[model samples]
Structure formats: structure tokens, C-alpha cells
Target: MATDKIKLEEIILKAASVGPYGVTDEEIRNSLPENVAPNDRLELYNSLLQRGRLQLKKLHGKLFYQTVEEQIANKLQALTAEERLVYSQIEGAGNKGIWTRDLRNICRLQQTQLTKVLKNLELKKLVKPFKSVKLKNKKLYMLYDLEPSVDVTGGPWYYNQEFDAEFFDILYQQTLRFIRGSSSAVTVEQVASYITSLGISKEKLEHGDFESLLQTMIYDGVVEKLYQRSNNGSSVAVYRSCRHFSPFATLGDVPCGICPVYKSCSIHGVISPSNCVYLQRWEQSLDF
Candidate 1:
């Protein structure tokens, strides 16, 4: 797989930059300096065809970008359709957390059958989580993206190893930029709602792509959880979307009983307040 017969690094870089959409070969070729001769391009292209190199291809009369998935698919053309489906789920997450139900919805599989496929994937050692927890009889799975397997030049390829924190950080930035700064609110649903209103039609969010992107944002420190206390104050409830780096940095380990700012503070109430002065700073901190 590491054969130097082809410029794998170059191909992978091109593919990684263009995934989610294909970049044509002509795009790559045209990116070359205006001074280059067309004959040189033709010679180089024919050499690749003659040598059976993987870095390039001619398709639909235009050169398009080939993502790491496409490269892998070409190399492992023998994999069964079921196997490819699992691989798609793994890549589709894009460093975000992936749930069995989300995967089922993405692949359009029945809920029961999705469970079996998830188990099969687990048994194969192809996917796993950094950690897992059960709440209210639901299983939440996280992805530990593998960076070691990444080529010297990185792309969205997953090798069997631990996920790199930096990759998650990038994904966080991407998702946060998508949300229009509304993630700072107290409710996950609120953040989600803000996004929905900005003309992100409900269908787009429901497409599983947006959800996966949101999951990655939450996993990375780019966005955070805004825990709401139940009226009884016995347990905390998670709102729909989540908290950004907004005010109340720590989410207050202290309940109102212990908060130093409890009595005189105009900040959060015994519970979190709707607005905070620190919010602007958090908003500015983002690359937006």
C-alpha cells in the first residue's frame, strides 16, 4: 500500500481538499503555471496511463479530484457492498461522534438491522470510541480518529488508530462557523433552532451530514454543553444543541449553594442566565 510507484501523497492531498465534492483533473492541471506547455502536460498524462499510476485519472472528459475514499475504493474494489456501507459511515462522520441510529438513517437501514451492522463493524476493529456512556437506556458512541495512519500529508483518511485532537479541533471550527454564532446559548435545541432559522431548511439538517458535523463541534472544545437544572435540582438536563466558549467557562462545578457569585451576581441565576457579558469574548475568539 505504501508503494512509491505513484505520488500517493500528492493524490491524497488533492483528494482531501476536494472531498464532499470532486475536483476535476483539469482543475489540478490548470492550476499549473500559465507558462507551462500543453505538450508537456500531454506527455506527463500519457506516462501515467502507461505506468498505471494511481495519482491521476481521466474521467467524463474532465479531470476531477479523487478523495481518499475514492482512492481506497479503487484499491479495495473487492470489498462487499455491506463493507463499503460501514466504511462510508466511518468517513461520513468527519471526526464527529457517530451513533447507530444516525448511521442507520444515513444508510437508510431499519433500526434493528443498523444495530447488527454496528456490531459487525466493532468486531472487525475498524471503528471504536474514545469513551462511551449509557443514559436513559441509550448508547452514545464517539470516534477516536486515527492520525498515525494519515499520510505525511493529511487528508480525511481513517487508519486503525487513535484520533488526533488537532483534527477534531479543525472540525470544531468548521461546524461552529456553520452555526452563525448561536451555539453560545443555553440550549442545544436553541442553537439548533437558530441554525434552522438561518435558512438551513429542516431537510438539510436532517440529512445526517449536518448532525455529524454538529456532533464533531460538540466533541471538540469549540462548542460545549449548557446543562440545565431540572426544577427539582436533582439532575441536570442536556438542552438540544450545546454551549460555545461563551460565558461561564467551567459551567460552575458549584451549584448555587456554593457559588461565590450566587447572591450578588447578575450573571447566571441559581441556574444559568439567558445572557452574559462574557459571550462577546467567546464570539470574538471564534475564527468567524
Candidate 2:
């Protein structure tokens, strides 16, 4: 019997192999074992997106995707560094984020050493884990632990909002959509209002708290800063695809050949899998 990963890879390759395109949820469902639930496959689909193997989008309230390769190369080609700076300080500079274990695992540390950096980070509001649920049984850190670049909510910036992960997810997505439509570079204030217009309640993102997703996006190399004139002057940033900048991935470089998308991609064109049975189909497709 074929493994679930193999089956999903087949589905993704088929969908991505074509162009001017879309692949329906049903088409996705058809590729999986019939006994599996629809939502189960949807979960699988989402995993692929998070792994950078797929690019998920909502159109007229319907979700669809193409390969991350095509999406980065096409939909995000016009993205500029100036626009990327729009959300630079949502968590701002000088702040850091790392997994709980990795923090504990950094070299030159005692094996049993423990500190309340997480707690201190929380108290100063310089960092936060962002989500309510624990992923990998660890807090997913964010930029809220850092000082805010401006009063995100005092007036025009809007900061009195509550926390809702989905809303900020859309805010980050709004930055992406804004980049897609921007004929020229704009400010973070412009990006903020554009995000608010997406029907995400402004009350949830008034403060710098919810902008963590955008921070992670920048750290991940999906977006990059163009420039900064003064500490807070018209600091323009341009956004571009990380593929050209870092196909090897930036933030999530857990070493070895264990990446979720390794079976289907090279992230960078450097070292890769070949003559290995695990990638026979993908290799065949690449004519390797």
C-alpha cells in the first residue's frame, strides 16, 4: 500500500504539473484513500501548505493552491523590498524568536541550565508565543515581546484590539495581497488600514501584539526589509521572494534530510536527494 505522504505528493505534483490552473477540493480528495475523511485530507492539504510544498489561497471563499514554486515565482514576483518594510517592526528589530528546545540546546550552555527568559520576555512584552495551543508542546514565540515601533493603537495605528490568531493571519495575508496590488511602495499605516478593510475586526489587531505572524514571515525570508531612513522615519522596505534570497529556508533550519518538503523540493539548488528510492517519482519528473 502507498503511504499517505506518497499519495499526497502524487496529488500535488499532478495539480502543479498543469498551468493557468486550479485543483478542486474534490480533485484533492480523489487522490487520497476513500476511507479517509474529507476533513482529514484537508488537514493533510494544510500540512503541505505549511511545509512550503503548497500555496493555499481563498477565492470567493473557496480554498485552492498551486505549487510553492509557481506561486513564489509568479504571484509574488512584483513584491518589493519597500512594501516588505511595511510590517518590519510589527515585532520590530533586535527581537528574537526560537523554539523552546533550541533555546535550551544552544551550545556553551550547561546541560541543566534553565532561565525565565520566556517569563521575562513575557513581562517586558518583548516576546510572545502568539497561539493559545502549544505546538510541539512548546510556545511559538513572536515579536510582541519587543518594544513597539509606534503606538500601534493610540490613534491611527489602532491597538485596543483583542487577540485572535486567525485575524492576524489575515493581516499578514493582507500584506501579501497588498504587495500583489501595490503599484508602488507604501507605509505600514497604509498596510494596516488595507488589512483592516479585509473585514478582519480592527479591535483584534489594534496593538502590536497580533502582528507576530508578519514577523515570522519576514524571519522566514518570505518578505524582507528594503531600508530605514531614521529610527522611525519613512523607513521604506521592499518585499521579494525568499527563493532568490534563501531557498534553503532561514528560520526553520532543523538540520539533516528531514524537512517536510524535502521529498518534493530542493529548497535551494544546492545538495539534494538522488538515487535514493524515496524520491524516485519526483526525480523521474525532474528527468533526473
Candidate 3:
């Protein structure tokens, strides 16, 4: 029995060694000797666990088996003392990422020192900087290999740090054109399918992306969201372009809308709303 147990452990370990990502239970079962019974195979797996040589974890509904060494590396040990501290804070926040000011506050480091540390970490490929779609001006730091959270990524409407403004505009117009050119009110799925048929990259365009952009257009009065009764006596949500829809309704509607110096035009800056030439022009136009 002792010799059989040792043999089973070796077989399992050998199978695991061959799997770079870790082996599944079925793989181990298949790797066992043909003469080995199912009951004995189950016992071997338990024996390996009791022997402390094998580790098991369930991920995404599958059991992954690996040796202790095959587990994740100690990420902190590879960094400098300050980098480790900053990384810990960033990793703690996970996909949400850490804001520049909050990271500085947590690390209690000078601005220059923090900037230098972040740059060094980025160069080492250990950490990276990304801007949130919700707040484009604020830079958030996250692990180099991790995806930003939905909140940080700003749903499917954003690509990288910048919003897909051009894509949104194109898609909005295309959707409106489809609705106006068609005889019937369009369903959400039809709009999504039409966008997909345009051959945009699946990674950049998703169903949720269409929903978000359409909702925004609806709120802006470019499209109308309505529910119509179906043949089954259930109401289905549909969209139609508003009769008064203006493609450029959002542009130049506010003072900042047409401001070329919008970036530098802060509330308390030299290029502020109070001293803006555009504002003055609009005010004079109102007087006339």
C-alpha cells in the first residue's frame, strides 16, 4: 500500500509538472495507470493532498491542481522598499486603482519622490498609469498586468484612458440613420447587431457599449426610448430618432463647448470663465 501511494503521488506530480497553467482533475485521472480503478484514483488524489506535496484550487468552476512552487510569485519581494509600499497600496485597491493624491497621502512621500518612484516602477514593468474615463484628468496607478475595474474603465464606452468620442458619434449617427431609414421602430438588439455588422473590433465594441451610447443620446434628446406592445401582449423597449434630433445639439451649447482653451480654463485660473473672450462675446450677443 505504501509503495502504491508513492507511485500514485509521482504520477500526479508528473502530470502537474507538464501543465504550465495547472492540471485539472480529469487530466490527472487520464494520466493514471490503466489498471488503476476509479476508487483507487480518488484515494491517490486525497493521499497527495494529505502528503502536502500537491495544492488544489477551484477557479471559474474547474479544479486546478498544481505543486506549491507553481503558485503565484511573491510580487512585493521584487520591488524596492518604497516601491513595495506603494505597490501594496495599489494592489489593495485592486481594479479600482489608486488616485495620485490618495497614493501620495498613503505613502506620505514628497511629490517628486513619488513621481520618480512611479516612473521607475513603470519602467520595470511592475506598475502602470491609466486615466479613468469618468475623470480623464486624474491619473490612476494599477498593476501592469491587471485590467482596470468597470468603474475606472468607464464601461464599454471608453477605450484606454480616452472616451471613444469619434466612435460614439459615428455609432449614434449610424443608429439614427438606421431608425429613420427604416419603417419600424428598432429594438436594442437590432441596433447592437447593426453596429456589430460594421466589423468593428469586438474588443472595442460590445453590446453594453451600444446601450450606454444610446442612453446618452436619448437623454440628450437626439433619440426617443419607447415601449411598444408585442404580439405576445408584452411590451418591448424600442428606439426612434427624435423628429427634432440635431446631430450637433451638444456642441457649442455651453460656454466651454466651443472653447479652444477649455483645458486651461479653470475656475480660478488666468484663463477662467470670468475673463473668457467667448463668454464676453456671448454676453454682448445677448445685449444686442
Residues 1-288 of candidate 2 have per-residue lDDT tens digits of 358666766676576545534566766666556787767676777666655566654557776666655443342333343222221222222233344455445422333432344454445444555322223345435455243223221322232333355654666676776755777554555666766677666354553433444556678667654555756776565443343545534533433345565656554545465434455553354421
Across 1-288, the per-residue lDDT of candidate 3 in tens digits comes to 899878887888888766645799888888888888889887877766655456676668888887533222333335578886787688667678889899999999999989988987888777888888777899899988788878888776577766777866777788878878868779889987887788654565666667787788787777888999999999998988787755445545567776677898788999998888777766676522
Model 1, span 1-288: residue lDDT tens: 335324533543454356444566566565554554677555545544333232343456765444444434343354456655765666545444466666767788887766666665565555564322212233434332452221221223121233445654554454466554443333444445555676533233432434455555555445544456667886543323343353433333224445555456555463343353354445565553
**Worst lDDT 10-window in candidate 3:** 68-77
RMSD of 2: 30.0
Assess each prediction's global lDDT (C-alpha) against the native.
Answer: 0.47, 0.50, 0.76
Query: In each prediction, how many residue pairs overlap at the backbone (N, C-alpha, C within less than 3 A)?
Result: 14, 20, 0
lDDT of predicted model 1? 0.47
RMSD of 3: 9.4
- Point out the worst 10-residue segment of candidate 1 by lDDT: 150-159
Best by TM-score: 3
TM-score of model 1 relative to the true fold?
Answer: 0.32
| Candidate of highest lDDT | 3
Q: Of 2 and 3, which scores higher on TM-score?
A: 3
> Candidate 3 has which clashing residue pairs, if any?
none
